[model samples]
Target chain A: MKVMMSLTVNGKLETIAVRPGATLLEVLREDLRLTGTKRGCDHGDCGACTVLVDGEPRLSCITLALQVRGRRVDTIEGLAREGYPHRLQEAFDREGAAQCGFCTPGVLLSAAALLAGNPHPTREEVRDGLAGNLCRCTGFQKIVDAVEAAARGEGDR
Target chain B: MDFLIEQPDTVEEAVRILAERPGAARAVWGGSDLVVEVRDGLSRPEVVVDLTRIRELVEVRETGDGGLSLGAGVPLEHLARRPELAERFGALAEALRAVGSVPLRFGSTLGGNLATASPAADSAPPLLVLEAEVEIAGPGGRRRPALADFFQGPRRTVLGPGEIITRILLPPPPPGARGTYLKFARRRALDLALVSVAALGWPDAEAASGVRFRLAAGAVAPTPLRLPAAEEILAAGRLDEETRTAVRRAVEAAVRPIDDVRAAATYRREMAGTLALRAVDRVLRTLEGGVA
Candidate 1:
């Protein structure tokens, strides 16, 4: 049975009706049309579906939409500010951090979560923090550089 | 994938719903494992009783006996934040820290790890060494099963259909005991354990009357298991080269491994001893915290 639930997604209030087993990834891409969050492996192994739920990076692929009923969920779509790119996004773009780009949104959000909690993270910390998201391109070094730059409050200037 | 998702606010209500539905109902927290199983058609429960909403299952309280009562729903991410808590249960912290990655850790619950009952579960070996007790709530009210008796097989546990784990009771490590969990994986991050070993030792006790050792192994057998034969030999007293080699051999012999996608059966058997020895040495060096 489909049920109605209210949730705060990317700063918007959404009262969406969804099947009981519908994942947060499904609702984000299909229902709300916010395709920023990509679905890689729906089994939670691939971090390509990563999103921020209550400020923590979580795999949306395995997260039931009903599970985040009244919680705040932030995705890659929420990272920009009034059409202005977020620093992490800017850093990734400037440093050529992304390659294939399928893993970019998830990696960016994971890094966003990292910077939000720890503004000046070490390189190793960045690697460990973003270990969930796999980037087959750029060899992960540039992604680490992008995250480190964002952590130091760089890329905007 | 169409099922009834009920978020019960209290333990009693959740238990009642589960009991009424029996095998048709299942409990979920974090849903990292269950949801995937549901999507893959590996498991089909009519009702998924969300345990996250139940307050009693999501807390981590220090026990009155200088131990810790880990709420089953406590996220693995919480372990990394509390360095103080990690220091106290070093092996468990190591195991959990090695669990998926940072993001998945935010969503993976300890209870889910145990209930999922994967043979390569990183968290189980440490709990085995810590002599943890599982607190379960079922139709009969509550029962605390020792960690040893908890596993029936892969993805199978002793938990009954209507029962949910409320908390896990872990008594503090021996006053001078050092704990260590060593995991070997094909990759460092987001991979299950190929072979892991968790061991605790009292150095002074070892020097005095052979050392008191509690050892457990993972991913090498049906479940994360405590090595009684190895423990008996190590407990017989002393960490001599002969004894160490004997312990390793005993562990290698004890495990019944199988050829899985992750590793070959022979390799798992070989690594089990190597990891076991490393875990023992690791605890010895815990008295020296990364200096070695």
Candidate 2:
């Protein structure tokens, strides 16, 4: 059975009809057409579908679409303000952190979440924060450097 | 995607819906595990009751007696960082952090973990050692059961029809007590435990062993088991090499490990003792003024 639910996505209120069993990932990409939130494992194992729910990083692949009703959801699309990219995105681009870009959205969102709580995270802390996100390319050294540089406010947009 | 979701504002309403629907309805917290089950066609419920909205059910509070009451809906992600909980129940905090990744913990709940009743549930061994009790709500009202007696087998518990775990009660740990939870998995990030151990010890000069210890292990048996045999060995006398060897043998004897995809039965049996000893050593070190 489909249910009508309302959730704030990317600072915008969206009222959509969704199946109860549909994951927040599905609703984000299909129903709302916010494809920035990638779906990787379709289970909780992979962090490819991570999103911030009420300011906390949560797995959207396992999160029921109706579960986030009336709650605030921040996807990769919302990580940036207006047309400017988020600091993490800018750092990723400058550091060449993304290889295939499939895991970029989830990785960037998780990095944003980590930095939101700890603005000046150490290299170790960045690795810990991004542990949930998997990157087949670059071996995460560049991603760690990118997050650390972003934390240091190196690349100002 | 074939079910309807019911978000109840209170426990009473949630219980009512569960009672009226029986097997047709199920209560979900975070939906990290249940959602996967539903998606995999392992469970096909007509309705899923989202219990996250019940404010009282997710709050972690201190009991009047200095103990703690954890609402079943409290997420592991939030609980792992709670300094108050970490101060008293350090083993539990460690176990919570040992579970999946940061994002997975955000959607995993203690109650949901207990409800799933997997033998490898990371929270079980610590809660077992902590002597926690579960508050279950059903059509017949509420009943509190010791966490030790809560499980029957894998994916099975004492939960009755329409019964939902509402809260977890943890007694205050002894002053100066030290504990540790150690998990052995294929990979630390997102792998289930092949064998896990939890140990909590407190100094007691009057006791025969000169200390009191609580030991438990996971994934090696049908349920998370309290190591009474190992505890008995440890209580026999001083913490000598012979005593430690006996404790290892006791743990190996107590666990009923089986060959599974993640591990072999013989290997689990051996590591169960190894981790149990390591956990005990860490606890002893902390109790004796050494760093954990």
Candidate 3:
């Protein structure tokens, strides 16, 4: 049986009918057409499906769609407001943090959550914050640099 | 992947659904473990009773006896950031941080960790040393059991039919005691521990041994178990180089590891003692705020 669940995604309220066992990643990518949330490893080991549920970075791949009912979910698409991109996203661009861009969305969201709580994180903190996100393209050096740059407000300029 | 999901607002209601369904139902909260199991065909439940909606299972309260009552549904990340738990129960705080990742920890619960009953559970070794108790709610009522006796084997626990772990009761740390948890994994983050050891100790000048130690290890046995042989050695006298070596050897001898995909039984046995020694050394460190 499919359950009708209403959730706030990227500040937009949406009600959709989903299977009882459908994953949030499935609903985000398949049902709502919100493909910004990647589906790397459906088993939750790969954090490519990371999203912010109530402002916490959670793996959408393993999260049940029904679990997020009535909760605020922020995806990578929400990182940019209108034409302006989030500082972390811009910093990634400036630092060449992304190559294939497969893991960029999840990494950006995880970085967003980390910076939201810690505006000025240390290099080690940035590494630890982004540890869950894996990027086979760039050996994480550029990604770490990008996160630190964003934390330093380098992207503002 | 095909199952009825029931969200109960209270523990009583949750237990009723579980009792009614019996073997057909399973309790789930922060499905980090259960979701993977279901997807991998390791677990199949016709109905999943989601307990995240239960208010009583998501709090951390002082037990009014200098102890702490940790609600089963409280996320591991939430507990890791708790100042009281961090200050009083250093080993537990360290162990919680050693779990999956920041986000994974946010979605994994203490109850879910214990319910899975994995021998490699990071939370078990520390809780065992702290003498934590698990409070189980069933159709009849609630019963608290020692955390030591909670596990029967890998993916097994003492929880009976229709029973759900409601909370974990943590006794207050002994006066002047310090503790530490050492987890040996291939990598730091997102890797299950190959061998883990937790130790809690305090100086006791009047006692026969002049010190008291509680030592336990994980991922080296069927269940997380105390290294009584090592604990007895430490309790015998002062912790000199000889005593440390004896403790290490005792731990190596006490553990009954198995050959698994993660590590060989021999490697696990050896590392378990090494980590145990490191944990003891860390717990006995004299520097203020040095112990984790």
Candidate 4:
């Protein structure tokens, strides 16, 4: 029951064969080999599979691949343009926001999703915005600071 | 368990697929809950009639009666920020905000929440208190039913084969009415409610009717319930200490809860009354020109 579906990933159109009930998370990690999105909880509880679908933060683990057929999907891999990291990424690096890095992709994308909608989010807003994502390393303070700095259009050297 | 999935861009196409293959087909909105079921082998839908592409099913429009008619696919993430909706429909806003997490909110739809029909569905009690009605579509066209009659039991609804919920219509609260939805949960995020309460009330001056009030409870019974017996007592009566105590008693007596992993029946019964009093007290304060 593999189905041919076209996905618009990282501004590129790619057609691939996927299982009938394959999730967007599976397609991103396996079929397409875009491993930036992690598989956490495999259910909707953890935001480790967070991705931007049409500029909104959505849980890719629960999203069907068919659901995003013609939609824009921005993953952690899509954060950089022309080989430079996204400002959010730079800010996180400069602030030492990532400890384990397992949660980085999801956290970065979740922050990017928030900054896209609210460019000047407060620190509290950044925390509230990324409440879905969990950092097992438990370095939330730095992550929130990184997001706030990114929202203010500040980046690392 | 392998199956074919169909994405119908239009309601007619979706309905046609469902009508022809009702047993094998299932309609999905957000897929937040349903995807887990399919992935876990709990339910293998031979054909998933994806309804997300039906454009008209996801828009939020102003109703003819000055209320809001939420397209079944309206995402909670988009609805929570509307200051007017949050201020006017506090209970629903709170309940919507209480759903899974921010990321889940972006994909989950209001219609999907109602269609799940879980006794603990966070959106049910809020909709019940707001006097919401739902529009169901099938091969025969559409039928609008009161939200009260929608639920049969846990994971069951009046929705027949080939029928899908298309929109939720909510009547405006009284001019001065204040509404609140409160739920007790294990955690602030990604947790199901242990017990939830929704209340809407207004003083005589702001109320279109005499001391209008409505009450509903969730996760403490077989289905989300409307406390008509309690509403009957609060609707026309003056706000008094004894009357408030009576309201709590009525709610406590009305709940038919059972022991579960989330809570014990005794605790749910007690919290039902506690939350009920708190929900009404907040509204009453607003009615008396005090802080809400």
Candidate 5:
């Protein structure tokens, strides 16, 4: 079935027709061409498809496209301001948070959500907050460091 | 079968839709497990009754009997954040804390967890220990069943075709009661349990009595099992070396585990014994006015 839904993506309002079975990841990557939200494990195990649904990190791959109606959706591409990197994105670049970059978008989104809620999270809190995101390449030490740096408002370009 | 997605604002409307749709529709709350199952092709429902829109099912009310009524749509994250739940229903709160990750906890509903009926589901053992009952609504009427009787087998429940779980009633523990939930998983976050145990009971200060315990083991059997024999042994006296050994033996006997990818049946049996002993020992220490 087709469902017409209004989604505010990256601060822009968009009205799109989505299939009931289509996932948010598919809509972001295919329909909207916001390919920054990578699709890893569509089953929600991997955090590669993470996006901010109402400023909270959510697994877009498992979330139905129709469920995001009247909600603000933010992908990794949406985090930047007019080609400028977000604080989290800048920290990732400076601290080498992304090794392979496959998990970068998801990690950035999760970290962004964490920092938005808690700007000064402890190391343990940052680790626990991003526990859902899995990074096989960087071993998560650098990611943890990046999140810590971002939370402290340090190491930003 | 027609694809019908009903967003009912009230319970009556939901029940009416269920009555009209019969077996074709299934109530979806949280959709953490159901959505995954549906996406994986395990369940193909003609109608998806989205219960998230129902505001009435999102409340956490305290009954006059000092018990808690968790609406069917209350997310696990919300349950974990309740200070009163942590202070009063320690086992339940601890179990809620250990379910999946923060994102899954935010999206997963307690009713959905119970309805999924996974033996390893974190909420079930604690609810079993709490002697929780579920209020289920169907076309005919509403019925309440003890949480234990709600499960028929793995991924199965006694809920009729058109029925939906509306609320979970968890009575407060008796005065002087202490409860703890111990989960042994492969990792700290987002891992399924190899074996888990929830112990809830009160201390018997008089005579040779120690803490009377109720032990519920998860992920080792077809359904989470209450180790009554182990509880009996604990109720006999303090869980000293001798009693701990007896309780461990009873727990080992109570569980019927299977060799899965998570762990071997023998390993699960051993872990169940260890967890039961540890949980009982920890609660006993608390009862003795020592911090655990």
Candidate 6:
């Protein structure tokens, strides 16, 4: 089944044909080639496929492609500015948050959503915001620190 | 695949299409659970009825009768944010808040939770405790059924082939009554329950007359089970140590759990008793006039 969907991805408008069964993760990665939105569990269990749907972190792997019609989607790739790293990306780098980097993109997106919603989130809020995303590396302390750094506006420095 | 139909206008239209094409269509709201089920091949339907466009099903209104009539499409996040729901039906609000992570909550619907019919569904136990009833629409007409009678088994509901749940009616909590919902899981969020319990209490000994102690246990039976025996025990008197112990025993005895990936049968049975006791104690301490 094919349906016409108009979506704004990473600030760009796109009209694409999507199947009812096609997931947002598939469209983002396979159709748009935005591989930054990694496919983790395909189910909602893992946050490895997290992305920003209208500035809110969502599990893209389980989200239907057609469901995002007329909605805005932001992937990790969208965070980059002019070949440079976004603040979140830089923080993840300096704090060594991306140990394996397999979970980095999703965690970064979730953190980005949090920072966008709350400029200065407490440590507990950060923990809660990223609760869906799992990281097998960095023991999660560094990821928390990275988000904290981003929130403090220290990522640029 | 023939085609996909995205009808988001009204429940009447959704139900019309569902009845016209039964096996080919499935309703989509929030898409938190349905999308995953479709992707995993657990469900396959040709036409996807997107219910997010239905404005009527998204409302949460206070009935003139002092009850709450929640649209089936109301998001879990919205339910969690309602002050009245938090104050009057604290257990249901808490259960909604405990579902999945924040993002998932934003996309999960109360109707979706009920339709999924998972025995471990977080919202079921609380809704059961609230004595909630569901209004379902089908080709024939609309029918209302108690939440207890809605679930047939795991992932199965009493809904007809083309029936769509329209609203959930929750009776107002009695004055001086407070409720609490507790779930035990291995992780902090996005985890299924090992065992969940919802307990409501009324503080006034006299006003508490005929006060129902609806106990809904999740993940401890084929479907979410209401502990009539436990409710009977609590109705006898104040929830003291003795009454609490008796209620716990009744809950443990009523549940017939099985060993699964999430937990062992024995653990679920034990936690049924433990969670019932803890929830009763918490409600009594917090709301029942500081009673033990």
lDDT of residue B244 for candidate 3: 78
Write the residue-wise lDDT of candidate 2 on A1-157 in tens digits. Answer: 5779999998999999988778899999999889988889887777889999998889998888888999999999888888998888899999999999988998998899899999999887788788888888889999999999999997777
Better of 2 and 5 by TM-score: 2
TM agreement with the true structure for every prediction: 0.96, 0.97, 0.97, 0.94, 0.94, 0.92
Docking quality tier of model 1: high
Cα miss at B45, model 6 (Å)? 1.7
Question: Can you rank all candidates by lDDT, best first?
Answer: 3, 2, 1, 4, 6, 5
lDDT minimum window of 10 residues, candidate 1 chain B: B202-211
Please rank every candidate by TM-score, starting with the best: 3, 2, 1, 5, 4, 6
- Candidate 5 lDDT tens digits, A1-157: 6778899999999999877667778889989999988888778777788898888778887777766778899988888887888888888899888988988998888888878878898888888778888888898999999888777787565
Clashing pairs in 2: none
Error of 3 at B130 (Å): 0.3
Put down candidate 3 lDDT per residue, B1-292, tens digits, no spaces.
8888999899999999999988889888877888888999988999988888899999899988778999999999899989998788989999999999888988999999999999999999999999999999998799999999899998899999999999999998788788899999998999999999999988766656666789999999899998888988888877778887898899998899999788999999889888888887777784244422
Candidate 4, residues B1-292, lDDT tens digits: the string is: 2567788877778888999987888887667888888878888888888788889887888877769988888788888877868877888998898888889898888788888988989999989988899999989999999999999999999988888888999898777778888989987778889999898887564432356678899998889999887787776466577777888788989999999877899999989988888887777777656522
TM-score of chain B of 3: 0.96
Local distance difference test scores for all models: 0.87, 0.89, 0.90, 0.85, 0.83, 0.84
The residue-level lDDT of candidate 6 at B5 comes to 58
Error of 5 at A16 (Å): 1.7
Instruction: Give the better candidate number (1 or 4) by lDDT.
Output: 1
DockQ, every prediction: 0.88, 0.77, 0.79, 0.67, 0.43, 0.49
iRMS (Å) per candidate: 0.8, 1.1, 0.8, 1.6, 3.0, 2.5
- Candidate 2 stretches with Cα past 4 Å from truth are B288-292
Tens digits of per-residue lDDT for model 1 on A9-106? 98999998999988899999999999989989787877999999999999998888899999999998899999999999999998899888999999
Best prediction by lDDT: 3
Badly placed stretches (over 4 Å) of model 4 are B205-210, B236-238, B288-292
